[model samples]
Target: MPRTALAPDLSPGEATAPRVQGWCPGALRPMMSGDGLVMRLRPRLARFTREQILGICDAAMRHAAGLIDLTSRANLQVRGVAQADWPALIDIFGGLGLLDEDTGLESRRNLLVAPDWVAGDDTERIATELLARLDELPDLPAKVGFAIDAGAAPRLLDDSADFRIERGAHGGLILRADGRVAGVPLAAGAEVDALIALVRWFADGGGKVSGRMARHPAPLPAWAMGDVAPGPSAGALRSGVHALGVVCALPFGQVRAEDLAQAVRSSGALALRATPWRRVLLEGAAPDAAPRLAPGWPDMDVADLAGWRVEACAGAPFCSQASVETRPLAYRLLELAQQGRLGAQRGAAPAGADTRTVHVSGCAKGCAHPAAAAVCLTGRAGAFDLAFDARPGEPPQTADLGMDAVLARLGVN
Candidate 1:
């Protein structure tokens, strides 16, 4: 494939200017990041064919920074694009059927489907139905989203969402509001209607404090049903008739465009699915065989619990808001934790303490993994402030620890 020509006289200030906080980026209007412009593409049905993947890779290398990021919402972003090249890049994405004809429609289509959904399954059916009715939904908060998790067991509860349509215990469809335990029982034919009604209720009666369904203060509709039991923890890899592929992470959720493009081409899989867990699902390939396609690809096995335990933001030079680099530190911490180096020194955590997960944020904003972690590191003027199982902005246990000191505290020599 031929490379696209770069637009002339693009400057750093023009390309990397800050964007509105909480505003999501899309192909039509990309957000400016520390690197450059970031154009996010949400693949319909959370899927893309091999051809689409290749085209995206080519476009990224040709017009952007040759880097692509898999977002927590099961979307892909081509980062570090020049301001001048955005038009050509958007044109390329449209050619790949990646852009919605109307930008409004694209923004409203924040739906996540079960990555392992098979043809004719409840997940696929309901997602398709809901997608078609997106025009009917009222204007919602930019970050508000929905999850369609109709697998035998739910796989997206940990993912951020304002509403969810998941499998009920009795094997029926249930539409549940986020941050609540119960959901209204929905029959096969009425799922879409119930979802729209709930969305309407939120728009009409929800409080001003937060647009999220969890923060809404109004009473739920009378049609609401039974309490929802939480699903089993998401395993790194799943093997079933519906889900037969491997799930792998990008070292702190960053990937070179070329590396991913080469892997997909070599895998021979027809499609790829992004997961909210900072992983990619290679459909139609065995777990063991898929990793061979890309050298240095980290395919997390079921037993690799450490790999599933760390989350970090794109810090420092890549994010204008950041004061330090996050991913490199996260990678180091993960290595030490996996080797039992940290565990050996700190001893077993208190019963019920969350010792498995660690979150590294670039600044106090905590853009990545906003929730508390077993060990949290927030950056401050190139050093770090440490906290234990606490949210960002909470006072740190120890302040202003340099990189070496932070590593020492983690018991990493």
Candidate 2:
């Protein structure tokens, strides 16, 4: 569901904008945060060549805070970018073929592809066709997007998208809506046409007012509803060797520029593919490359980890809207894992029971993890409000406590 901005707190006759933002950041149009700027890059097919990867790392080190964030949409964000250096950084990106010069086309080409797609597969072909026909799309809302999950089974079921191209129970193609269970069946190669038609239907039906396809209340057209169900989920992809490459986890979906460059060099991978799950697939990388990345970086092959399930935003001084620091608390939670408080908690009992998924949002905006988590700590007036199995903006079970008080509530000394 699309989240509305929290109501602003204002005095009589005084005015202020709501703390939440509606548009997403892009490389051409970045967002201003407590940090300098957040410039997001949506890589083509969520894959980056070696040259592009090295160039991005170099540019990040030169023009930003040297930190790159992997987002839930399988995009990359360069943080702490100075306003003065924006144009220079963009120039560098253009040289690397990372920039989409047309702003309208870039915004309209919001696509999420299955990372495991092989060349000439349905995933790549449909995504390529849609990219070429982006100009044909109507002026839809910015937050709306499409997912091409035409692999053996849909792997992006949990990721956000307005429309989806997935496999049906009989291994045929289907164009599914975000909220609907069934979808329109498609001929083997007619996915792009069907997707375009569905998009047009959404736009003609006042979908812009809803801001996202899932939230659009209009019923689907008669032709758009095929009674067949989608194929079973392919499950979450973890860090390990696969037929195409080696997957590695990025703790908190963040990586230092230096470490990323080092991994690229050490692994000698031909390319890197980002995923919504905070894991990167190093294409053509040797299986042993995972261990060579770093000690702190776990590949999930031999390491029992919980950091992959924790989400934290840039807190306090880094974000103007945040009242308290968040990452430190997230790290503290990981440290507690050493004490056997939550050892090897991944894939165990559900979230609230064993505290598997944790989100430490700097403020109620919950920029890091918008959905509900097992444990949530939301910042408010320099204190923290704790919630159990809730989103950051939801009412908390405990409120108005300092950091130490929060620690005590979690049973920590």
Candidate 3:
């Protein structure tokens, strides 16, 4: 796809307005947190070329905190940027062809693509078409998003989105509203039109609710549910992959810029695709080449269950809204979970058991994993609030327990 021409009016001042809460930050309109500006970059297709990756890392090191966050949405965020450096950073992104020509177009381009999509595949075609027509989309809420899961097996069911386009049982494309089980089938090459119609319908009050399509109770248009197979199991890909290139995870979805840069350089991979599950699909690396590219960056082959189970947000000093530091505690919690120490006693089983998912949020917002987890630890005034099989804001089993007390209670030494 050719790059859209840069809009003359584009400037740092024209970035999305700041919100105290509930909204995501973008490159143009970054959110101010305790640890400097939180600037998010939404790649066109959840992809980054090796050069692009190195450029981003360099930018982060010079203009931001040198930390690159692979968001659950499969986007990359350059966190901890200074106010004065925002313009320079934006210019750097523009030079890298990362920024959209129009600010509104950029914010509305909330898309998640299956990382395994190959060239000229259904996923790549449909995603590229939808992005080209972003101007036609209705004025939906900032967070209302779309997903293109055209892989033989769906891969983004866990990822949040207002609408989803996936392959139906018959191998035809289906445009499904987020909450609805059924979807209207699209004729060959009609995916973009149907998707636009659905968005327009929603904007015209077809769905009265403002957030995700699932949250709205409005009935879906006449469409039949196809016998679509369930999505593939969620986790890092098996080490010896057959079709797609090697897939691996960055521990806790955190990676140092230099480490990532070195990995990309050593792997000899042309590009990297970020997945919603916090794993990165190296485009051309073979099974043996993956580890050499990013050594010490935990791979699924070692402690697969523990690496995929735990998630934590940038809390405390990094985020102004957080009451305590979360990542460190999350690491400790994951270590205990892996050892089965923080198990049934904490109202949850071990990592590989039924309770395989864990979320440690610095605050009630649950920025890391918005969905309910098998075990949830939310910070409250430097103490932790415990919730089981529930999202934040729901009633908790205990509140305001210090880290040590909570650990002891969970039987973690």
Residue-by-residue lDDT tens digits, candidate 3, 242-349: 365667666677666877787677766677788776567777766566533235422433244543378777687656677887866776776666665654653544
The positional error of residue 320 in candidate 1, measured at the CA in angstroms, is 11
Model 1: how far is 272 from its true place, Å? 0.4
How well does candidate 3 score on lDDT at residue 141? 69
In the range 1-413, model 1's lDDT, one tens digit per residue, is: 21233442223223333323555777765666656677889988889887898899899889877768888788999987878888798778878888775656777889988787888898888899998899999888777889998888888877888889987776677889887886777877888898998888788775334767888877787776457554553433342223546565665666777888776766555687877766677776554455432244334322345433777776776666688888678767766666656543333445665666677888876755666667888888888998887655568888998878988876676
In model 2, the Cα lDDT at residue 389 comes to 72
Clashes of each: 0, 0, 0
Report model 2's TM-score to 2 decimal places: 0.80
Tell me the deviation in Å of residue 119 in model 3: 0.9
Better of 2 and 3 by TM-score: 2
Per TM-score, the best of the predicted structures is 2
Ranking by lDDT: 2, 1, 3
The TM-score values for the models, in the order shown, are: 0.77, 0.80, 0.76
lDDT of each: 0.72, 0.78, 0.72
